[model samples]
Target: METIQREMTVFARRARASAGRMHPELSLVSYTLLGHLEERGGCRATDLAAHYALDKSTVSRQVAALERTGLIERLLDPEDHRVQVLQLTDAGRQLLLQVTDSRRAAFKERLADWPEEDLRRFADYLTRYNGWTPPAAG
Candidate 1:
């Protein structure tokens, strides 16, 4: 089991390196944060940081980068002027769509031989593990 786990870690790292080359300048953390916003439509910066267990400063930096790139816009909260809201712009949405497609393609390539059951089992175990594990460090 240790050997298998070690092998999987190496494989995962190689896969991530490949993906990084295939998608340059795309920060995994940034992508992940954007995904959450995409899933929830839009959310407060504070709420997003809390949900992801990330530092507010880290989240803020990422948000600022996205905003500078015109990928996202920090809108003034209508109900509460002090609170800021984050929302994806058209470019951001399109970029996410492209990135999602690339990830699906890559996963399909990597798991081409695995049976449906194997895939399901892997996903199930990952979901179970994630439920208990704390978020990764920033």
Candidate 2:
């Protein structure tokens, strides 16, 4: 368990550093938020906060920054007139595509020498690990 934790920490740090190098203006949080917005089409700030287990204030700050940079915009939710949902703009989508491509290329290069079976096993392990959820707080 300790080894797993240490490896995950190192992996996260390297991933963040790589993402920073790819886009100087984007933090890992913002990049992840943008990805979420893209996937969901649109969702409320509160929804993002809940989904990520993040504080509303932190999500609000990132949303405000994205809004200012024209990466994301608030739109009135069709089903809920009182709620505003965040959506990515064309620029946001384009930037995300570029970043994703860069990341994929980097991963491919890093894993070029790995055997196919090793890659498959590693991917399966990652999926299983990601799917595990902690018990709810009592």
Candidate 3:
């Protein structure tokens, strides 16, 4: 428990520092949404809201900000015009790559002295932590 808590704190500090340096508009939620869009190609606002367990209005606002920055593009789904497909624009993809690379560089620098076994164990634990079984999609 202590280790997990410490790990989370360290991650938070790193993320906060990076976000602060990157832009005043950046937040944890923004980063997370960017990640989802990057991974999923295009997503609906409804799906994003459901997955994040957030209010539609809040997600809409975040999407608005991303759109304003040209990070994401909102499109009407071809198959279903009623639904929106939120996709990362080219700028957004580039930004994602840059941020991920920067974070990795910083993490690598910090873990330079760690033993290989410790690094492997940490990676295994994080993989497990990130794995989740979603409830049936509606």
- Window of ten residues with lowest summed lDDT in model 1: 18-27
Which of 1 and 3 is the better model by TM-score?
A: 1
Can you write out model 3's per-residue Cα lDDT over 10-45, one digit (the tens) per residue?
987978877766556667688789999888888998
Residue-wise C-alpha lDDT for candidate 2, range 79-115, written one tens digit per residue: 8889998999999999999988888899999999999
For every model shown, the clashing-pair count is 0, 0, 0
Which candidate do you rate higher for lDDT, 1 or 2? 2
How should the candidates be ordered by TM-score, best one leading?
A: 2, 1, 3
TM-score of each: 0.84, 0.95, 0.80
Give the C-alpha lDDT of model 1: 0.84
**Cand. 2 TM to true fold:** 0.95
Q: Per-residue lDDT tens digits of candidate 1, residues 1-138?
A: 999799879977875776576567557767787788899988898988898889999999998888888888888889999987899999889888888898888889999999999999999987986689666789
Task: Score residue 35 of candidate 2 by CA lDDT.
Answer: 96
